[model samples]
Target chain A: MAESTEVKLLGLWPSTYALRARIALNIKQVNYAFLEENLGAKSELLLKSNPVHMKVPVLLHGDKPICESLIIVQYIDDVWTSGPSMPPSHPYDRAIARFWAAYIDEKWGPTTKAIDAVIVAGEGEEAKKAAVDKVYDILVLLEEAFKKCSKGKAFFGGDRMGYLDMAFGSCLGWLRFREKLHDIKLLDPAKTPQLVKWAERFCEHPAVVGVMPETEQLATIEYGKGLIAKVRGANPSKW
Target chain B: MAESTEVKLLGLWPSTYALRARIALNIKQVNYAFLEENLGAKSELLLKSNPVHMKVPVLLHGDKPICESLIIVQYIDDVWTSGPSMPPSHPYDRAIARFWAAYIDEKWGPTTKAIDAVIVAGEGEEAKKAAVDKVYDILVLLEEAFKKCSKGKAFFGGDRMGYLDMAFGSCLGWLRFREKLHDIKLLDPAKTPQLVKWAERFCEHPAVVGVMPETEQLATIEYGKGLIAKVRGANPSKW
Candidate 1:
């Protein structure tokens, strides 16, 4: 990585999207200034940088604020030439990486949101069961992708951690946090053994160890506590 | 580009997403077998290629299936080492291109869907008015981005018709067609002169000319006709 490149990351501490950028930066060994944003009272810099989305995980390379987590991750990989590259050099390989990374961005949002809403904040049993089924369906698709697409490699980016790995790895802890908080296990060992193993490897990866916040700490945060309260507030009769 | 490469695109004739892929291939001068998919009844290849989305605009390069329009466009640019690159060579430039291209993809869907449901398929005047306001808001954002980001350049991808240009260029015609069919003029010259000029330039660009389907032809298609019927069927008092 080029030294003296002034890099700053504006992020919400527990955000998976923000985590994606952080993990990418850590993997690349790029030194960056981290600004934790109060999403409730978003900063002016955040609004100006994004303008379109006004969301965080916005990367400030000097004055250019790169919005979107996955986009920022790609930007990081491209700008920083050291460490293992995120996407493979081959065009086709890059496409595959882009495809799965995009998939992670697209799928993770709705899948987790459904789980959060119906399982964490839901009022009834039927909705929770339906949400569980929906989440499981998403997990099954991912599990199959890992089985078939990984080609027996440890990570989606191949033997080493890459863009796809970072994309999922950032959220893996959040998934666990949700599971522990809500007492619901979506990534069952038998059903998604490959993903579970990948999760283990991702959690233990040196690049991610210091970067990723602990689940217990995350669970105690305002966002996580809110989710816990929602889960607990569900009708006792349904339970 | 690369000759003798077995490139095939599974696409819907009138889909803007599919159009994005087609225009990219055309720009690259890659010989692709365009398999028109009946979105009403998608083909097996389409299903197999994109089991997750089960949508059109799936590119099959040899045996590998690349799904998602923007991703496919990037893949085409990467795989075929000829013509102008979709993303610029500089990392920051590439990031900007990727950011805008993504912005177009994310914004276009909901904006058009709102227009389709309210101004076209709507039964009330108030709803139609509200939808028009919403659509205008989306257009204004794009207009602002073009004015500020492009820096008086011809396209979003800078001076040349790059990835961001292709991303928006592919869908620009659809917006025009919708405007004409629905009798609403959102892309007014006065309100969005830069985008209006860019649209004309996009339509006339050699890279896009042969690839883009005629607006008249597009308006006569089953999908286009359905939209027209909805608009016409809407309360005349609103008109």
Candidate 2:
């Protein structure tokens, strides 16, 4: 056997990415030490370890530092010893899994920025409109992803929670969080109904349900309201 | 073999990423059918094949399209059943290799935008200054990347060109092209001497040298005096 090593998760409590890592570890049945971070006043260990971005969900295996959430998830999938597989095995299947994983990485940023605008933009009518447009765009994309192609599959890969599901777990948290904060229900059953169903099934999907973030973590999103508003107010041209 | 299949490459001539796929194919000694596109009037096959991005080089093996330049490189790496390895074998080494590949993807847009400013914004004093500054910022980053880390080597991974070198090959063609357009040397031996050596060696590297675009390609940059005037006249904010 290769050397056994300690696994430590350095994460922000409310981060959906952090939650994804937790669910992945639980799925692989790997026991890990969890360190909750104060994102505002990040620890010396965190700062020293991840000097490049200094972002959250830094998964440490032994002495090595893994930054970025999706990369960490991929690493976990690669490193898992005894596993009921997270990524698809065949070349085409693996390509599909990676494509969707890359898809989530590509879209999640713009979608969340949209949601942030909906809840955070204070009477800034233009920002509000942009936010609505972003949400509509994301919801439509999510709708297309679920209700269209691969419609019959339980997950992106049929009958299993593959890499795509883990990539998208970020959105599920944001969907619920945004609905509460913005006082709007974007992921309504009428629009993206299949996705809503999938999100529910995903929430209860054994490994995910047991280790997912509790409802309270969703509340912390309001902190970004002020920050995002400042960014919106600042003219991008000046930069 | 899963099925006997023909390999095809759909690409634009001046594109560096397209050149990347070309180099990888040459290195693997894989015989592939090449179809160059007229971007203004794209081919039906190109549209039907990669409807999403409609960009290239798209690697089609057995009728399956593998889009994205780096992903195509990975596919080439996987399919080159009887060729020399491009990336290292160790998991940690491969992790570092992937780190640099991913880095290039993250930096492409921002770096290219900055480079575009340098090439086209030459008409006004302020515009030229901004262009020079942008080039300096990228140069600083490349210098840091070239600096001796724990490995005591200059290349992204020591001794040999790995994933980073291959990924940077895309940037190299573009840089050389930009240098020609601007008529101001950014990566001269005087300023960035180490990087200058690295770039020279990069051009001469066995794998990279084979499919490199002609020296004349560097002379024919995609810019003009009209572009310079237009960039100078417009607000730099859009850039």
Candidate 3:
């Protein structure tokens, strides 16, 4: 338990994946050092810690490193049991939460990257519209999920912000930034009113307040452009 | 607990994903009805049970359904606590297990698919060799992982077969099938001695014995060719 204070996180400020870890740590009230990683020239510690992926955010709990964002979030929930549980209490509910979290990562993450690719390439309006439609389609399903998970409560964790909230909320910044840059409304209030309200509550939560980067800040860092660049560089055919 | 007897699984005979769930259920001694899903004409139960992916295996405990193979395995482990644990006991160990499981799914699955595609297309020997080499490269890494995870024990779960074991073990049939059809050695003993030995033990385990299909059975079903056909039909460009 004493080594809990020795926790360190390797992350990039702009990464929504990294933001998930920070938000979870804040929720658990786990004080930890944050080390910024430069993707262009990854630190030796980051490489050594997560040799497989070599991707942030890697949570160095003592000398042990946990990679992948959602995995790290679950790890935090597992290790720090004193605070509000991140995943649901029941096994069935946990499975459902995990299902959606994976859905977001697998479906939403790639779709978001596609949007970024389209935007970065300054593709035709038709392509842009198609990309935007894909995101909206996903959000429509997520709105239904929010209703089911929250059970008319304020957040996905019911009374508090938990796993699903952090999983989805981390993307809000980039979503909002994309909207601002393109003058589009991905989270259409009329179409997904509950999610809009939930998004408001999620952003305002104490654990999430300072953790998420603002839309303007994302624009300043050219996050969408940089992300697509890195992704394309890694796999040219993907984007 | 009354509903524990009401367990039902929707899966295909040849799917490694589905096999993971079956092995876990067998390990836990959970008596369950197996419902075969025809991918060409998916049943209404499969569709309704998992509306999102509409893929197998779907584990239905009473009326509740859990989709995705690994998630189902973990759910079985969670709900059926009397049996041996599937995932490792410690939180860090659990994270490591989850990490490797995801690796197998993300990396190994695709590489296997590439090999299948090359074989089914009757591609040139050079293309086939390249695909086979990719799988061998992944196996080398898994061999090292086995050493780390098993810690010189009989299985990844130490004395018993656990999460990582089932995760990788499910694919043994297909790996063996590829080796047989191509007259090559994918799990080369000289290259990945630990994995080669571990695969043998995994196949012989009580939980996995009847669950995993024989390589001959896989060849009989034309699993590799059929798999590539499905993959191509779903996403023409991926394979």
Q: Which candidate's DockQ is highest?
A: 1
For candidate 2, lDDT tens digit of each residue in A1-239?
Answer: 12388888999656778877887777787778989998779998799767756877888888887777766776777788465567666555556556656766787667766656444446566766677676666667756755433449887655777667777765676666555545467767887777777788888888887556554465435554443345445542321
DockQ-based CAPRI category assigned to the predicted complex of candidate 2: acceptable
lDDT of 3 by residue, B157-213 (tens): 888899999889999988877676566798888899988889998998888888788
* Candidate maximizing TM-score: 1
Lowest summed lDDT across 10 adjacent residues in model 1 chain A is found at A230-239
Flag the better candidate by TM-score, 2 or 3.
3
Candidate 2 per-residue lDDT over residues B98-143, each given as its tens digit: 6656766777557655756554535566666676666666666666
Candidates in order: C-alpha RMSD to true structure: 2.9, 5.9, 5.2
Candidate number with the higher DockQ (1 or 3): 1
| C-alpha TM-score for every candidate | 0.92, 0.81, 0.91
Model 1 is docked with a DockQ of 0.80
Model 3 has a DockQ score of: 0.76
- Clashing residue pairs in candidate 3 (N, C-alpha, C atoms within 3 angstroms): none
Candidate lDDT values, in order = 0.80, 0.67, 0.85
Cα deviation at B159, candidate 3, in Å, is 1.2
Instruction: In angstroms, give how far residue A196 of model 3 lies from its true place.
Output: 0.7
